[model samples]
Target: MSGSPALFDAHLHLRDARILPFHARYVKDALDVGVTACIDCATRPEEWAMEVSSSLAATTAYGLHPWYASVSVPNWLERLECVLASDPNAPVGEIGLDGIRRVHDGGTAQRAVLFAQLDLAARLGRPVILHGARVWPLLLRLLEPWADRICAWQLHGINFSHELLALPFFKRANAWFSVGGGLLKPAARLLPELLPHLPLNRLLVETDSPDRFPIGGDPLVLGQHQLLYNQPGNLRCILRAAATLRALPVDELAEQTAQNARDFLAAR
Candidate 1:
């Protein structure tokens, strides 16, 4: 690993309350292993505030995740806009629709919030980090109108499908695909098989730390619940697994994905 390229976690939540108390250790461990950069995403307004106050060294992204969509305060949109406006380089997201969570109005609220943020990103010419679970088609349909307007889209934790590649969003040069520890699961046969088919320049990697802990991940202890939290250091394990699936040397893949991450983040 002496000559390995520094890794980039394209999407994660270092500002997450669950792991914030020990973020310094998590960041240090990640940096020691060559994860030189990370895009720390805030799922809601409070987390955004935490990002502003925290000392974590990361490129910050702000948005309301679907799970928190219905619970957002009245002035959340205005606050979100202010955060993005404060930093032009920052991306807008970790935002999208999730059908799995039972929201009051059957996802109507999620769509409304998602559109507002998407429109804001387009207006400000910022890239977006999107999350769509059990609502991929609806997300795609929602994105079509703004596909050309937004600078870039990081489809975080994507589940690959050949049909998805044919969509206008995927056809655009601005689209990026980020994969995480979920790809290491035995049941994720499709992702491994289709991994090579994804455009290399648009592919990125992440840990989604404090969640999505890899199959053989290096665990960070969570004392109260006795839970295993995923840390950024596990990116090395993910990179190695991805390299094997793609039949490329780990270093080669690391550099490629790192460059891809830089391009995605720097877009616009």
Candidate 2:
């Protein structure tokens, strides 16, 4: 193994069947590029089994994503607890409220599920992975009661304003912000601006691969002509963009974020 700290992907959905065929390739690419750790977060029931079975060489978190807050069956919470209990290292997450995607009473269901997971995380003293889309204000408010209870939190694919970073929860709850390929876009407002403000120790990075496929983001697809998905290897682009915004050397940022990710998992 290399002496330098390994690169870390703070969040992604590697267990998704869409990327199953590329598993070996993804692992090789991640290793070749020095990315040694990742948190593969599962959103709902379908991914739970895959998330458990996959030998992806990464930590995993299972939770009901906000999009499925209303749809996920009542038994999910019990199942999630069972999974988390099975792996001492598994954390609770990818759980939070969404404002943009409208479902029947989505906001209400979102809050209910979020609080349940938060309660579970607190009881278990496990770290949490949170997702917020346009619902920052409410999410922050909801987090207040559980802030002291959470062991640690990673705001995945975070794109919030700098002003929001000043909130006491960031400090009190021990939060880390994850930046992904979204930062590569020139039009992205929050990430580029927030990069400089992130405490080096609290800064984390991810590809959110197979999702946020930005311009020039990676994978040397040989036969296929069309762009279909993303790989964890594309994290190079995200790290480069973040390094540029933070005015830090690539290696330095990589090491810092890797250490941060380890600490995040260790917090559990």
- Which candidate number would show the highest TM-score if scored against the true structure? 1
Tens-digit lDDT string for candidate 1 (5-48): 88888888887887777777777778878888889888888888
lDDT per residue (tens digit) for residues 137-222 in model 2: 66886688787799899888888788887776766788888888878786888778878888889989998877877777875353
C-alpha TM-score for every candidate? 0.93, 0.92
Cα miss at 241, model 1 (Å)? Answer: 1.4
Candidate no. 1 TM-score: 0.93
Pick out the ten consecutive residues of candidate 1 with the lowest summed lDDT: 48-57
